[model samples]
Target: METTHSPIRPIPVHPGLPVIGNTLEYLRDPLAFFRRLQRDYGHERMVRINVGGRATTLMLKPEETKQVVQENNRNYGRGKSFAILKTFLGNGLLTSEGDLWRKQRRLAQPAFHRQKLAILAETMIEEAVAWADRLEKVADNKPVNFSTATTDVTLRIVTKTLFGSSLGDQLDSLSTALANLNHFAINAVVNPIRAPKWVPTPSKRNFERATTQVNNLIFGIIESRRKTGETRDDLLDMLLRATDEETGEGMSDEQLRDEMVTLFTAGHETTATSMAWTLYLLAQHPGILQRAKAEIRATLGERSQPSADDLRAMPYSSQVINESLRLYPPGWVMSRLSLGPDRFGDHAIAANEGVLLSPYVLHHDPASWPDPEHFDPERFAPELSKERHPYAYMPFGGGPRLCIGNQFALMEMQALLIVLLHRFELRPVPGLQVTAQPLISLRPRQAVQIYLS
Candidate 1:
């Protein structure tokens, strides 16, 4: 006997204004718009909404989302959405596609291997301990903007780990240039009407100047390393020594710069933002905070620094970090462009269309998470987590292109939390409202003010 299959249907389109479509609604407030879609048509699996004069499909179901990002990822390339990022990153692992991406991924893989990351964890703890000591000296029961504090510490850690050198006098200017460049890139992504690149708009000029500043700094490091032939067992050293298995060739200076900058850009702020959110959430929930503290005390005893083995023993602390990431994933929304036709259950998607998969939306789905808005780390307890879909809680993303530094980020967060929580008690500032700002990463709109006593 032959079996019959259901007919494929066109994806449902959300009603929108002519030409501009849903762009206005999206621009006004992106997360709200996404939540509204989930509330209204979430069962539809896929819904099409026009943004900036183009139709983009939103993948609403976890199963379909998994297929697009993991199983059929080849058909969904980085596409035009990453063009602005490419202007700065220049075909780095984050933005590259096809053979170049494959080659880059291969060359960079060994640096993140388990043994290598074990060595890097020491630097993470050292930096976190240094940061905690500095805070103790100046905190004096006054509110500190932990967002800024975490950013500074994480930048230091990444600088030491990646280049094996301190920024020294160049730190402030380099930080400012990256900040300006980030602001420019994000604005360009959202605004539909952009002046030609040749036009010297103030924003464009700033972006160009920032790009030059960053390029010069990175190239200077590369030149110095080549001339000196020094070895520090840092990421740059590994990259310099890494040879392609296929051709026995190493990355050129330009390639090294791109990867280093990419790592710097993607690595630092995302970890810092997540740490700030974790701190904010802990401040708000004293009981949960105490539980994490108890676990840390039991695991590490009187040790000021947590080794890799000690970090692995703190299960509750890891759960708190996972729960915080679910609430405020730094890489909130991920985009892919279709290289060919595809189907999600009964719905069909055409070639060249843009598809969005939001970890933020998936994480907050009521089907997978009961009382989705509640902050409950117990939801991640092993027994409960085993029953949930794997894709339901992907804070670092999923599949072949999953963030390379995910383990590095988690270990860093765990180490910092252990050191800081051991030394001080965190309290929230009264009458302050913290909101999430969606940028290159999800960050707090204002400083997350907390007092240490």
Candidate 2:
């Protein structure tokens, strides 16, 4: 009963050329290529993929993923996994490692705890309602560019949650700056990691402009707060008051700015992408849509407005969000380098051997999910999820580095979906397919159009 699985031969490699493995193939159509691999080669394969001149094997199996994320977490750190994000996010929590990351994580932890989220839920609801109410005016068959709508809402939510009302008009420059910065980060990923930021390229110049814009805007906020000596009870207030529990020291204004920018990027973009996918899924499946509507109608009872309590009563709404993330995870692709020797199920992985995982692949594994490609929210039903492997459905990722903003995301998504469903029926426009565009988050390549009926 206790015998360890013996090491097996390395799984068959997918064909590739020298100096460049499956990079071109992957770049062409990653999701489709991944599907082709899964059909030809199951989860255990060691298919080599060239990632910007580096030959790294893509590890697709769920147990393989568990080894990297949970059992041997310390031996792995983000490494080059998020180099592309470095251009925009820098070394904030999403990409940093070792002592810096550990210290920052400790400092930022209190602002995202359960009690904090409960308090913030009111603000989340306020922002969701403000956006949803605007949609009530759109006529039937009029297409709504949901991607833009969610982006605006998530940005505003992050702003209000972080700064409260005091910094109201001050956020305009920050939002404009961030909009340009995200594109630069997306462009960086298309090129090699070694390219210097000061390359005189158009994207590089644009990146600097956006980065400078944010830096100037943040310094202004800090100066204003310092001069007035006023502390609003938002994320900014929490950071100001948060003394390091171990050392009793507080973060510098510069430090706070870095963390603020981090939250703004991580806190909003991923959630926007998640919202886009959730709306697309709702548009695709009207049966689930009606069930979701019934829950909202019954709980809220023909009220023109819905409260947080009404959102809580809709179980199927939460399940729909969960299922959407399952099928199309926001943090879809992740990689980590081994710091020391490790053994995964059957492979002996040496130190610095990079491990790759695509949540898109693991979430849709045939062995783990019935008709793996299908979108079924019931898969997240408590009873059903318990029977599945814990690692099989990781959209926010797994283990310690899992996104701290996950609860913030889920709550916002639930509230938004509840309000939208109760207000309008979204139907997909003809001939438009929702295609995944991988960036820091996975988004639909085309604008996910939903006609508000």
Note the clash tally of each candidate. 0, 0
TM-score winner: 1
What is the Cα-based lDDT of residue 13 in candidate 1? 92
* Candidate 1 lDDT over residue span 1-453, tens digit each: 995557988788999998889999998988899989988888897789998888899988789989998999999998565899888888789999988888988999999998998889899998999999999988996899998999999999898899887879777777788888888878888777899888999998888899999999989989999999999879999999899999898999989998998899877889999999999999999999999999988877877778878888899999999999999999888889999998777788889889999999999889898898788999999999999999998888898989889998998899899899998999999987789988768899999989998
lDDT of each: 0.89, 0.79
Candidate 2 accuracy as TM-score? 0.93
- Per-candidate TM vs. native? 0.97, 0.93
Native-to-model Cα distance after best TM-score fit, residue 292 in candidate 1, in Å? 0.6
Q: For candidate 2, give the lDDT of residue 382.
A: 85
Candidate 1: stretches off by over 4 Å:
1-5
Candidate 2, superposed: residue stretches over 4 Å from native: 1-8, 43-46, 166-170, 193-198
